[model samples]
Target: MLNRTAKFLTICLLAQPLPPAALTVTAAASENAALRDISKIQVDERRLTEAVASRTLTWLTGSPANNDYISVGRLANFFGFVGLRVTSGHSLKRSEVARETLSVLTEQQRTQMVSLVHAQKDTLNRAHEARQEMNRALEGLLAFEHVTREQFIELGRDYGAREAELGRLLAQTFGDIAQTLSTDQQRALTDIRTTHLSGERRQGNGGGDPKLRQSKADKKELVNLTARFLSWTTGSQEFNDFEVVGKPSQHFGFVALRIGSNHGVKRGLVAKEVLEILTPSQIDRLREAALQNAREFPMFLEVRAQLMRVLETSLSGGVIDPAHTAHLGAEIGEIEASMTWSQAAAMLDVRDGLSEAQSADLLAMRAKYTAETDSSDLDDPIERGRQLFAQCAFCHNSDSRQPIGPPLDDIVGKPIASDPAFKRYSPALVRYARAQSMWTEAQLDAFLKSPKALVPGTFMSFDGYEETDDRSALIAYLKTRK
Candidate 1:
């Protein structure tokens, strides 16, 4: 046990963040160096390199939602916003001065817009659920050795229909919002859209500057290494889940950590608990689990990469055909799911194995970490909400520049599923909305307590704020969105 501990320490020491080197066609020099070091122990340098490259390519071409080889998400990226800049900042922030200058929605206009959005909620929800179900079904078909072309075409047709419905809903909402806008407001939005488009064009001119891409790639590699280290140590699904370790994403590693529970505070705290509080027996078990994960990691990567290649080649004709390729995609999805499940299982095992004293010690460490990280002003719930909302910014848009989830501005007392700019409320949320006339404070509180519990099929990825104070503060902050 002592030798294993020493060996693990040495490996971690060697894995310490190193200075990034220049990029190469195949892989960044720094990445190769890091992988080479790991290869000496468990990973296969070449196979891992190929996998990483495929993963990176998959990210480059995929949507922000999912990194599937071929799915509605990828299709959305391809057919939805092929070369658009799609502004990253909030739409409300367009004006440096008074907020109303850019977004001139009166209470009446807001109400009308909200009503229009609400009307489409059922259709949008149904379409979204259909797409989701189709994706899942398609994912299941991957284990099969063969799939007919007709199968891919049929799935493609369904995916296309669902995607088209979503697009129509978006367009309809935008049209309704535009009708509500006066001439000046329309001009303001047009100007913002034009500026964003120009910026996108410039970015695409030389692939947004090779230097920028290279720098980003280098940093991403290091970030990936750190996340991988975190997973190997803690086995927390937050750092090692399906989206983070199981699949490739442009927004993997640190970026993905933003939406995790407790805003991922547990990630930093878990290592301390494992190192200082865990028993010798527990550590030995964790070490063995880590070793087992390390051994399996390379094979999963290799198979996933290979599957991605097969899917890409089979479906490269600018058509959404899933057939045999869907099988491969499904297999990839399964591998990703397995990766997540295995780590989560290991984490649960360790958790179940913990002594009450050890668990108490870990909880104490967690409380300490949470307190240390709590920089919000206790006296001001709104202020605290503003600080805490960082966890939410990733999914919810503060402004109206195409939200991943929904716009939160003036959400309190507003009709549920009534964001003019967002039309993709899940069926569960829509059902919950039908029972409630508006987003009452109590409803928000209960929903925030556990979103899935309140609205089971809602696609809001947040696990909900557990602390009552935190939830209150966030609701307070949200009340000020108007």
Candidate 2:
């Protein structure tokens, strides 16, 4: 009779009705409270753990992983669960079992769960902020000799104890809510917690306590300097240039000084520094505008200054002198003249005053620069060609994997048809690949000299190289692969 009664009770438990609406509302409220408490606990515990871990690892092993990766709140939550499991003696293999036990909620109940989860996440974010504040305080305290390791550890221990108590209370509250819920409601709550809460916990692990990287005064000064430099460089109203033929005549001397002062440019390094600082976007825009207008546009002084600084920092020697600056300005003018209108428009994303042909030219230029090449001989030109190749290098380099033309890395050995990553190949070139076996050095040399004639439908717009010596030198240089 007792066995039958036990069996009846089990059936009744399984057949229990869906929870009352009130129960779900209460559970959601309780879950939110629990999560908030858990967040605080986790954050506090994380701080303690990080301090201990950093000290132990540094002392014993002479190295430690970056403490910046640690999140006290997350660690607290994980350990809190471990503590709960320990106390309850629940030997569930996975949190999924708990979810399944709570899975019978309605759509409304699920939404409530989501709302609760969001609330929990917000609390965790606040907790993170608090942790950061504490860390900053601790960092400041470290400057003093009176605050010893023992004191730090003691403080951490206190934080940990408080966290553990919070966790215990949350677990107790959750258990109480679970008891009141119907079997279905319990399952829904479990599912929500497992999916939503679990994700929050995982994300909480890496957001380290914020450190005070700079003083307010320093930050303010930096901001001011940046604004001034940007205004001068970007052609903002502050350093307005005098207009010549509806275009601004750049203040070259002022630009040079700005570059020198900001970047510390000397003689030999000035030209190179200036070139390096000009972004592909800036150059392309300038070049296109020059081509379209058939005139030189003054460079923004602010832009020049920024470029100079970048150059000075990147190179060994200081900034450029007057003569070199003039030379650089001339070179820039020549390059700008060679730019097609289309290229300029593309850079600025401006359609004003640009012809279709100019737009087409810009697109073509961009395509040429972005396109991949299989020619191994492209980089190595003969000794005489080396000087000439410098012109080409203005738009190309190994560092950026982008030049005004395709990257020449591993071009020599690469099969013509195999590399799909090279998107710049003309349709004619693609067809040629199908017809030919591979691109050899000799074949590349011939093609470079007369691209359109070699591959009639090829999109290469450059006039073929007229000098055989130039072609041969270019080929020879290309042979010496890096």
**Each candidate: what lDDT?**
0.39, 0.33
Q: Highest TM-score, which number?
A: 1
TM-score of each: 0.31, 0.24
Which digits, one per residue and each the tens of the lDDT, describe model 1 over residues 73-111?
Answer: 222121112111111221212221112221344556444
Report lDDT (Cα) of residue 430, candidate 2.
Answer: 80
Model 2, runs deviating above 4 Å: 1-381, 391-405
Error of 1 at 25 (Å): 5.9
Residue lDDT tens for model 2, 353-376: 233343344434323221121122
